[model samples]
Target: MDKKLIGAIMAFSLAGSLLFSGCSSKNQNTGEQTAEESMIQDVESEVTLGEYKGLPVTVEKLPDVTDDEVTDAVMAAVENASVTGEITDRAVASGDTVNVDYTGYMDGEEIPESSVEDYNILIGSGVFFNGAESSLIGVMPGETANISVTYPEGYPQEDLVGKNAVYQVTVNYIVSEEQAELTDEFVSQISDCQTVDEYRQMVREALETSRENEREQNRRNAVWDKVLENAQVVAYNSGEVQEIVDQYTSYDQSAARDFEMSLEDYVQTYQGVTMDEYTAAIEDIAKQEIKERLVIDAIAQAENINGDNATDEEIQKCSQQQGYDAVDAYKQDRGSDGMAEDVKGLRVVDFVVDSAQITEE
Candidate 1:
């Protein structure tokens, strides 16, 4: 409240105001933006509406976006898909987990006929195969399961028709994949690898090899698929599927043949009955196979899996795997008809592969 001081403060305030008014208005970083200038440029050109394709599309539903979220989602969905799973005849497991062996039989039947190991992952994943995986679940390795499953219709075992068997499963141990670590010591321990790069190279090569193997197996599967595809697959009725299983596995003949007797003779000897009476025992099995095939086929359609209809390149690769020429394999698998059926199956599975929305665990 000193008069001189107050006058001095007023003069200073006025001078500062004038200085600010005369100062340059441009931003320092770009050397072009005025304080009053808009941060936005002509942004009207970037927006798209309605026609976008992607999950969680549109900025309204998406997080962390002012706009253009739909386009980003579309691109993200398209970029990840790689699965080359095998369908094998066996699997190994035991303990808390099913230490499945490719070798499995009804509980007490002795030596395993299937030479493959750890071939199937179906049951463990909740899909039952002969009820093997399902019965195996909820049991420890040291535990035993009198696993009884009806032979799949068209099952090669005629005697096994609704015939229950016991398995004294001595689940030895459950195997698990030990997660890999990128450490120098680990590299040294696993190989004669001197450097980390060498170990990485080894891993890359192993992955490539696995991919190639899967590709080859997929190709072989394509052959079977092709046949089924063009076979005039009937509507979802299981009878049509049974027809297919009969053709492929020829299980009925196999069963009778195993006993070194005609089916007629075996039927009479086993039950003192005619083949007609025995046929009833195995009829459902054949039916089941047909039904199973139908279910698979249905899944193929629903999932759009078309591996049976493979490409020229895919065929060529598969042929090379069997050490036979691609054309020769096609001829052997699809005489007179070319590879039409084979192609249909391949295409369906390919579509499945193509359409799957995958995620990493």
Candidate 2:
């Protein structure tokens, strides 16, 4: 099995719990087939769960989905459903989209990169230099003015850092974003609803669904953490640690390439750490991940929680029903044996969640 696949599955398994991310932010998995969905599918081989009872688990403050949240999401979606409209008389303002032609000069030399023709920009969008958008305030259409601003010292472009530049800017017209009305026509654009009320209901239900998912994930994490606390290991191996480290390094390098940055620079800029520090962080994460894998595997074996134990023909039918093109295709993409093992882990999680003594606060 691919080590990256194992890591990806681990991430998927714990994404909703937000245990591995170590950040206060939430992880929203939006994909055609989320990692959790793929792994939760039925297995073709027999599997088992281990002893997972009487674990003392505590979950605090279950998630709540409110009407205000739904309304906010709907309003934001409406704002994004834009229509082009001309600003007749008013000067440019924040949130207003406007077209302009501009040329910049620094130290008596024209900055070619700072020049744009018939460019459309959103004021206060931070797409331009600091103070550039604010300087455009009160500038009427078809008017020309010279605006000056200084680039910050730590600007990514070393040549432009701490330098003052003057721009000769002209406002063509504002292509203002006119929000769509809460009408049947507008609602149909974003959903299968025929009315505003139905659309709002759908939005509310979606928020509730998300909240429910979060609540369930929190409960499961609490149970798993309890099991870990009392877990006893007679023996273990560090053989998979190297594979995990290699996978982590490769993932970081790929992200650095996507950002068009060197690995060291990417670490410093995004992770706020040196390359060595980032490596040590990932190594620590790998250790924790491997430990969890071993514990889950041991539990799976002890409980005998076989998921499906279906024949090849049955597996093919199950795969097709789960939206796979074919059994062979699913196996090729997500190694059949690996997926089966993951399913067993999920079964153990289910059993633990069901049997644990939970307290909600």
Candidate 3:
């Protein structure tokens, strides 16, 4: 599955933001019903669930972490913990990060906009103009050289595009990285473990735990996929679908605001789609999400695990699982209805998974 589609599915699966409209009160005179109850009732009325229990699913068997993988993981941790220091003994070389002061000139006239002082650039990184950083290679600190660079076509500055410019660059000290030795001292500094062997065992155990978690997640996904495949939606509730679409749109609008771009521009730039295309895609995703929610609700209703009647103890347990200090805080963040619906959906998933006949491949 596409990562973006997976993210969208995960976002919708939470049930926190999903709200349905156009549902009648269960009690006409009292007219007091939670939104979650109305939503579940609306979904149950709209969707017809297929066989969910005892569904057959096949998932890949978990693989054991190999010695080579453990070694690689240890090396990666050490590499990430490397410390950088100045290398004044060597001249600038390829892949070296060096500091420099430079002024650019076009047609023998200085370009004020291109001049920079004490700028740090990685050699061959192309941070400076074409061939500018490359020219610094073999130049020692305190040395000055005139390097010519040609700006490529379609450069941000149209006037400088395809034009040659001379830069009088003075080389500064190069930055070098030092990797920590794998010894008891280093191990004690990095972790509670005081020996290299102990650190290796710790890393191996962590990797095994991570792999096991991945395998479990894959199994759960397989079960959910089978359940979704077996389910059927009789008809989509337009009000609910529109509500989900609105939520999706609002999320995109917020993302656009974060990027400081207009919605149309953001969609076009990041999604590579016109507003119409994006809207259509969002609608399709919303409909699929609604179908999934409807199926989950249908299962919850059939199994007598409806969220509307969730006990206070259940809510408190859920709040603790969500890492909230108190139920009140959790309820304030996720509305009471949303919290209950999330708990209900989780319970339904657990039930379906337990009932599933799973085979490891």
lDDT of 3 by residue, 227-274 (tens): 766766666666776776777677768878999999899878877778
Error of 1 at 39 (Å): 68
Off by over 4 Å in 1: 1-208, 211-310, 317-327, 336-338
lDDT of each: 0.40, 0.65, 0.71
State the displacement of the C-alpha of residue 220, model 1, in Å, after optimal TM-score superposition: 14
What ordering of candidates by TM-score runs from best to worst? 3, 2, 1
Worst 10 residues of 2 by lDDT: 16-25
Against the true structure, whose TM-score is highest? 3
lDDT of 1 by residue, 1-361 (tens): 1122222222331111100001111112232433222212322211111111111211111122222443343223223322232222233433223444443466555535633444334334644444466666555544555555555656675666665544444443454434454456555765677666676565556555665655544433333333232333222334443343344224435546988977577547644656554343333333323322443355455555444445677565434422344566545754433344334434444443343332222
The total number of steric clashes, by the backbone 3 Å criterion, in model 1 comes to 49
| Model 3, CA-based lDDT | 0.71
Tens digit of per-residue lDDT, candidate 2, span 1-361:
3443334433442232212211111333342533222332222211223346877777887658878898898898887786667775888877777899999898888986878898987888876785477677788899987988788777778988888988889999988767677778888877899998999999999889888867776787777766654554333234455566677677667878999999889778866777766665554455445445666666766776654564565455334423466667656765656456545556666778888888888
After best superposition, candidate 1 residue 261: deviation in angstroms? 5.4
